[model samples]
Target chain A: MRNLTDTELAARVAQDIPDGSYVNLGIGKPTHVSGYVPEGREVIYHAENGIIGVGPTPAEGEEDLELIDASKRYVTPAPGAAYFEHADSFAMMRGGHIDIAVLGAYQVAQNGDIANWATLDNTFPPAVGGAMDLVVGVPTILVMMRHINRDGSPKLLRECTYPLTGLGVVSRVYTDLAVLDITPAGFKLVELTAGNTLDEVQALTEAKIHT
Target chain B: MDKRLPDLASAVAPITDGSVIMIGGFGSSGIPFGLIDALLEQGARGLTVISNNAGAQETGIAKLLKEGRLAKVVCSYPRSPGSIWFERRYEAGEIELEVVPQGTLAERIRAAGAGIGGFLTPTGYGTLLAEGKETRVIDGRGYVMESPLHADFALLRAENGDKWGNLNYHATARNFNPVMACAARHSIAEVRHLSDEPIDPERVVTPGIFVHSVVEYGVRP
Candidate 1:
């Protein structure tokens, strides 16, 4: 009965992130969550290269030269931060130690199949980085992205035509317009953008939505 | 003269003038500002450096650019000519620039670490980039051949590391460090925290065997 705004949607996603959770915020928009995490709550941020306990982006003059995130963006060090060889960071991801992996996706199938790495177009060749490892290793997968493509195509579909990063790995979808829970029954609309109607939202999505 | 490799640096010693080094970072992210500071403090001059991108003025690998310490550079881009001391030297015919495609640069470093002599890829074909490079056809696809590249020394950053030199990289800092470590004759790592033994071996990103030196100072701008 209640709708959420974009900022509210971000807060909802942030609210679900428990304290002390080790999270990998995928590149692009997912990186924005770092600034949204409620202050005073401790969350350990892991970059693929090897830094952890990352705080939000530093102010212009306050950045530490040695500290940065997987995106190569400058960051501050959280208390008790440690650094090590890079293989160990991937090992943590591969060994299923990371609790949450927040990623961006091009398409999410009804069965939670995620296709984020590549497109069908050969002209736009894709880069398959550590994303394959993340989907397989991270226990919880949270996808943060825009609800639709620039051409106004719905990214959430009954099936993904694009190459999949992993099958049935997405646990939740955080979009600009709504929050969704990918379930066995199909995509369940958990929350909608404020002032937007279910009919309007469903019209925008190609996938069937269950209230 | 002994041909065998010697022991690691016992303590923090100043980097000498005219040293060749490889910096680990993508763009400005993992540029090893602390090491740059150490280099600046040492006032090393006439250095040869390799990296992905020269950090913009006052950032990343660009600190060396600001210091005008480099005698030569090999990278993808030249953002700050004024800050890059070597660029002026290059114009004056006193420096060298070995430009490379971003992907090829990474692959070259990787090939060096993997012990491969050379590799062929389509990343740069039929361009000035292919000049003087070997070309081959694999499965009817043409690829420009490139040789493996190794460094005299490599500087890297990691998230958390154990005493054994096992490393975990923060997100973007994972850029060039892993590959550079493998290609370098000697590897020195800068980490935020150091763990005692009994570190979960599964969590190790880089093995201690590859690491010859450790700098425990956390990343400070």
Candidate 2:
């Protein structure tokens, strides 16, 4: 199947999410998943600032300053939304309560290692933040990212060259070009975007693709 | 009462290997470049660096990456070239890398600084972010794992600092610096300039008491 657009990509990803699944969407494009969650599926959105039952973005002129996500972006609280102290929010992540974590990655290796956080340049610093906790805590890690860098280098690689966020954490990857599953056998092609072929993606990737 | 860059380096002599250190910034902007330079000059290796992102290659923390001085890195995103370290080390089975989500990164460090033990966040609930972790339902919604954060040293940067060590941030560059500052045991504030008196109470982003040392230098990248 050809996934034509980001919206379509989101909808496709949403299809796999079961009803009443607890999820955390990373910043940037992953934040958009809140809008695409299947209707009446009871998906609870967790903001790092301690809000759940996250509704979609609000209508114009109806913004709530008190309601915001982890990224500080304004949001609409769902019917059952609840808020708590920041401590309580982290307890949930550390306690192994969350079911799914979709994050953006700079690169994912054949072994499912994730290197989304820092680069290796000494002159440039690295920020580890909570990725270490999340990668180790979460069970099914999904990486949402572009297929390639602006310089045309592959973010999906035979091996990551950047500092890793977690070792052997990522299980699935969704990119602008294709959806792949990381296995001991390497990256298996699940689907491709419209106008992209397996060969073209393979040309850009350092790993072999099993259709 | 005041000292030059060399003196500042000497004051920081206690910083050592395996130390959990915090550096302030959002992405690559607003980092403590001069102190980082000092750390580079001092050649403190095998450090555990905590920041928003590793600096760009050859500019910020990337210098540490090149020197191979960092023992481990805890961050939200490590950008280009710096990523090569993982490839050679992890893929080749030599080094260790730990990843964290952006919001979770901010909250964990903030939690540590605030003297809180832990909290529930829905950020990484259903997918891989929840693996090998406990899950709880608060009001019928599942929230995944969350961990508390703390550090030995916090290296921060700010727009201005009062003699008392009060500080302020420039903009979105304010991301994780202030929060990380509070969570560490010792904090060093590096600023572009310092004032004779304390900054206005309302404008002070980080209180002087939380900060032990002040480095006057160029603004961080």
Candidate 3:
């Protein structure tokens, strides 16, 4: 079966975002989605630090220390960008002003609960930054991540073992193997990667997947 | 009346040991580095710092942590990629950390500044962060009661300011500075430009009433 590359997964996720949508792209793999947004779509990116209308990453030597995204990566402002304080930024988030939020996940349950912020391990300190706010505030939560863990264990599960960022908040998930939607019935398989069969994908998923 | 201070030492002189202080910034932006240096030079201990993140390694707040002056830190993002100082101290139990949700932390500080009592937020309701907090269901959604977070001193950086203390912040550098200016009992601003004349009223993001003193720092072009 052909597995999608990280950039390919990002492009697939970008294809689903509608034009002129105000979106927040979470740190890590989700940030890559901003670069793959289709041409002429005009998606306004929102950074939790205090910017709406975030633009593309700046070229080398053109980076500004003051203009940075939540990831602390240098970013240029799009035309008509606006800035505010931290409280106002989150108010825009929690008030449902953001149409969509794209995030990276460790596991997603059939019930749509997302676990991304923390693991059960004691070595890594768990830090729940803005994921809690974004998951609860944004109307549509889209998760982009690897379909399985490093040991080849399925991450799409009946219930997440890791601490959840939000309960039943995820609407859709895009992985290297397939695109799935969370429904009242369970995981509804949208499309699988080329050369992959339903049975093969289902074998890796713990939850009941409807093709 | 003019509220300008002649130097950074006098601006941060009021911060005594065991004081709760808010230092404005997101990562490295909008941080009052000059004032923080002054505080380090002053060598006060047992400080409780409120901020969005523990500053990067060997700079700003991390330096203070290295100096063993910080007793506790109340922030949303305590772990950054280069935050070795915080990580080392945290694991060793040398310092205390209260990790708040980013939005909740911002709102709590705003609540303190606005003179409002505790408020309800849905961000941390079902998460581990919500543990032991008051929870209420409003319109079928659960919310946790979060109290206001006030500090004794607020040290912030501004892009511009006038003698009257009206301030302007540049780009994303405006993150926590304005709100923190109001939440503290004494707000000291380290500004790039200290003008003899008052800043344009319409351009002021932080009104002078909230600010106690302003010190001119970095060069302005």
Candidate 4:
């Protein structure tokens, strides 16, 4: 069975974004999701670093140094864009004004606990930017990442061994191998990548995947 | 009152050793680099800093960290790209780091500025950052009790400043500057446009009362 490429997975994830929803895209894989947003759907992007209505990347020479996303990448402001300070910006998330957040995850437990910011590694400093905040208050948390670790270990787990970003926070996960929803019961299979079987995808997950 | 200062060195003169200074900016923008450089030249040792990032490379907050001027840094993200000084100091156990969730940090600072003693927030609940903090379940959601994070001084950048010290920022560069302005005992601003007239009162993002001084940067001769 063939797995979806990261780009393919991002495109697939973008298809699910509801039109007119206010969304925040985390760094890495989740950042690409907005680029693949379905045609005719209008999503107002929020950058947690203090921008609402985040737009497409600017041409190389046209970058406004003052305008950048949370990732520090240069971007144009979308029509009706607004800028605010960190306080008001995060307030949008913490107050549940932000409808959805697309984040990257290290592990997602059956109970929807996410661990992304820190691992056992202390060689590099642990930086927890807005992941916890995004998970804590954003109504829907969509994690986009690989189905398994680089070492081939499962990232969809019975329980997360890594430090928790938030408890029972993830609403759904779009992985390279499959898409799943974290229901009240547990991880439920939504769909598999093209040419992949449910059993094949289930084998990679440490959590029981209810079809 | 004319809050304008003659130079960067004078702008940072009030910041002393052991001061808890908040530097405004997220990533590479909105940093009061001129003030930070002046603080570097002014040579005040042993400070605690609050920022979105610790700093990158040898610029802005990184410069302060590299010079061994920072004793502790309260921030959300510390390891910025090219921020080798933080990596070195943290690994060497030469610095103390308090990693707060980005939203929590902002709210804490806002709490101080707004004169609210403390607030319950869901931002860091159940995470290591929330450890030992009083937590409660309110309305079926868990929240951690966090205190206001006040600083002795704030150094920030703005796109424009008027004679009255009213400030307005450029695009996303406004990040922590506005909030930090109100949270500190003294706030100094470095602006690209320091004008003789007050900014349109309606357009002022930060009122002059929050600012203690202002200095012009990127001025053309």
Q: Of the candidates shown, which would achieve the greatest lDDT relative to the real structure?
A: 3
- Per-residue lDDT tens digits of candidate 1, residues A49-132? 566777767899877655666565778777877664344666677568899998888999889888876577643323444566
Q: lDDT per prediction?
A: 0.70, 0.71, 0.91, 0.91
Quality class of the docking in candidate 2, CAPRI style = incorrect
Q: What is the TM-score of chain B alone in each candidate?
A: 0.84, 0.89, 0.98, 0.97
DockQ of each: 0.07, 0.12, 0.63, 0.70
Backbone Cα, N, C clashes tallied per candidate: 38, 106, 0, 0
True contacts kept of each: 0.12, 0.19, 0.65, 0.93
Ranking by lDDT: 3, 4, 2, 1
lDDT per residue for candidate 2 within B55-121, as digits (tens), equals 6647667777777787777766664334555344435443455656766877778878888788776
Candidate 1 chain B, poorest ten consecutive residues by summed lDDT: B1-10
Candidate number that wins on lDDT, 1 or 2: 2
Candidate 1 segments whose C-alpha is farther than 4 A from its true place? A1-6, B1-23, B31-221
TM-score of the first chain of model 3: 0.97
| B82 Cα displacement, candidate 2 (Å) | 5.8
Worst 10 residues of 4 chain B by lDDT: B212-221
Candidate 1 vs candidate 3, TM-score winner: 3
Candidate 2 residue runs with Cα over 4 Å from true position: A1-211, B1-7, B79-82, B85-87
Which is the better candidate, 2 or 4, if ranked by DockQ?
4
Q: Write the residue-wise lDDT of candidate 1 on B120-191 in tens digits.
A: 766445444577888987787557788888877787766676666677666456667877878887777777
TM-score of each: 0.58, 0.55, 0.97, 0.97
